[model samples]
Target: MKLKFDGFILALLFFIVLAYFFPQLHRWENGEVLAWITSIGVSLIFFFYGLKLSFKQIKEGLSNWRLHVFVQLATFLLFPLLVLPFYPLISSEIQHDFWLSFFFLAALPSTVSSSVVMVSIARGNVPAAIFNASISGLIGVVITPLWMQLFVDFGQIEVLGDVYWGLVKEILIPVILGLLIQPLLGKWAARYGKPLSLFDRSIILLIVYGSFAESFDSGVFETVGVKYMVMVLVVVIILFVVIYALIYLLSKSVFKFNRADTITALFCGSKKSLTHGSVFGKFLFVNSSSAGLYFLPLMLFHAFQILVVTIIAQRYNKSFEEAEK
Candidate 1:
């Protein structure tokens, strides 16, 4: 099986390097323009997300209660549990921020497009993948912040109030507006899914650039250093492997899920959303100049998940094709 290179991953890397060299652009006029641009882009991204969701699809996929429950639990609960143990062990503010980054990764939703696409490639339960992946984002809008609230403080402004309010304005309202108008535009949105997805990626790239630019401007990386980044990558890989294995064993052995459901659960359960990471990081770490530091682990995890899962999905597809032949 041939492994395909993801241009998106390369684009993410490119943006980070660009941010390093041209960090000034994001901070032009104290970053007001860049911040305004990303904020609008973030809302539109979720608006398009809402537009693409199908109630019929969600209803159809809900029948498989076991698979749905397993995926959600693994996403919101199991992933966070793995990282929670390390919270108390943090020795300094810097160490705490690094831990928060991984925890943020754990708390994110499963990415919708890639999870569904990978599952489809592997001959998994595609409808269920779509349902789980779609609903995961909506759930994360509420759950992710609550998870973060357990550890994060928003400084002077009331923590829960400001966080939830920002979420309402940035994510929930746009999504609801999209859902409300879906009857008129849902078909249009579906017809143009590719462009919408491209738009999503473009906004994500902008956010990454703005974030890293902030980090570079503040010299946050100087304190965090390359050693910690290497550590973050190692931890991200270990986290993915462990979550993937647990989902595999539980779905196949404990639950006796069929091949398709097992594949869907494995892929969807092990994934995290970089899109949400970028948007939510803007709000979650708003008080910290080191916000980009928090996004670093998530970006690493995002790239790693895509590369590893695509390889596994291709192997699954090849095996299925051989069996058919």
Candidate 2:
């Protein structure tokens, strides 16, 4: 197995184990310090990485209107459109908060780092992936809130009104600053990108642990039983399959992109960004128990997307090797 997958699985297992055994450690009051540290620290790291991106790259990416449109459609439009109709079918016994959270996950944008990595792995359009991924993050700041307003009642959450500004200041501004500094740090960024990405990924794992630890501490897990867990797992699987299949068909028929580009679209387009999901969840839900529940689908989707797309990417890699032979 790839080291990325291994690292993710290990991090997940560690969090689950921590939540199970160290109940006190997971408590919000007890863990608040760690949580804040992880949140602020990760946000800063995210900003620095963003600073390394160039405005010229963003402009060039925008110029690839076809790829941008297709990725956006698959992420913001198609996924949510598929998910909304099913909300009625889900049993009312399930927490409204959890349902809303799931919907939020569906509405978020494609991931930045992983999507680009997957695109590169599958030998797809790297520049296009960078463009689409960054643009998707920017668009999500606007689109996610609008979707929430239309579908969910935000009155319960105090942070809803200022969430976008928080994202802009915490996430977007940092990213923009990073891009601006790209001219000076471009070489340094290129040299250290891998290490920086690893650092970013580690911070994300901590965020996941902190979020879940908070949920466990708040008795959220006790409220959700085996049935709820099973339902969530099923929903996650269905979401992945439907999105993957839809993107595959669209890539073939409409986009007429090459095989590698199609794979990139399928992976990047079908998956949501965990980094954005975690940060936004923190901003939107704040100390609410539902924030953890809301981020559940995103966590599940991240693992599932990587596993599924890794297999697909490997297969694509093999096929390319065979074609050359």
Candidate 3:
């Protein structure tokens, strides 16, 4: 019923159906053109995100440094650390690239849009949520590539020379530019944040469609059977539950953040940024065919996270209501 569920499902279904009928749509004769479009689009989105961020909100969030630190640590450090040991558990066929992509998904930053949306839905601190989510995106640009370099070799990826700089140029620089101009746009962004958010969501939907369209067009599914798909889904579900449980326990025992802050941290810390994942995929993995495969886990994770977090946010809202009564 909610837009979160209905919109995502409809978008995904439309992508798949479109891919089935219009597989040729994915073929781009010029690689540079596609790269430029994706880069420019992502840069603009990050710029707008920075424009919406309020320095006053970030200062307030910084006052609760402990919660922010814990959430960031869990997102950037703990999640990847947990996935590292499981590399031995995956089969060799998916090892070199496929599994590496999955780990890359894990290592990505938290979702800036959805994290704040979920927190707001659950009646958590919106300003704090925005601060944490934005900061996480900035932090991830460095942390993600560094993590990859440490665990996986990029020898197979021909675009290795440009990958790091591409991330900085395409992702980080635009975001910085946005933040710099926040004062100019902050008032307008505040007034029309909802519409701008809708625009952001639409861009994400387009990226999703583009990624899946390429995958289906390239016959990636033929190489990976239903069994592998099932395995990945199971892993996604398990990883989601494990991270959710870990955050819950930590929030209750060690962190001792209030209910709202805990909810904010749990939602923000446990989710991955699909937007960042797709943009990074285009930038870092230039091999179009391989990039499509790499994006599969990210797409799956995005859908899974929204579904699970929607339910959790609803339940959290109910719990808060009961507590107030």
Write model 2 residue lDDT over 65-96, tens digit each, in one string: 77778989999999888878867766664457
**Leading candidate by TM-score:** 1
TM-score of each: 0.96, 0.89, 0.89
Error of 2 at 230 (Å): 2.4
- Best first by lDDT, ranked: 1, 3, 2
* lDDT per residue as tens, model 1, 89-184: 999988998898899999999989999999999999999999999889889989998899889887775656877787788888998888888888
lDDT score at residue 273, model 2, on the 0-100 scale: 87
Q: Provide the clashing-pair count of each candidate structure.
A: 0, 5, 0
Judge candidate 2 at residue 232 and give its lDDT: 80
lDDT of 3 by residue, 182-250 (tens): 888888878988887777666666665566666676776668878877777787788888988999899
Who is ahead in TM-score, 1 or 3? 1
Task: State which candidate has the highest lDDT.
Answer: 1
Alpha-carbon lDDT, every model: 0.89, 0.76, 0.76
Evaluate model 1: give its TM-score. Answer: 0.96
Clash count for candidate 3 is 0
Regarding lDDT, does 1 or 3 come out ahead? 1
Alpha carbon lDDT of residue 203, candidate 3?
Answer: 66
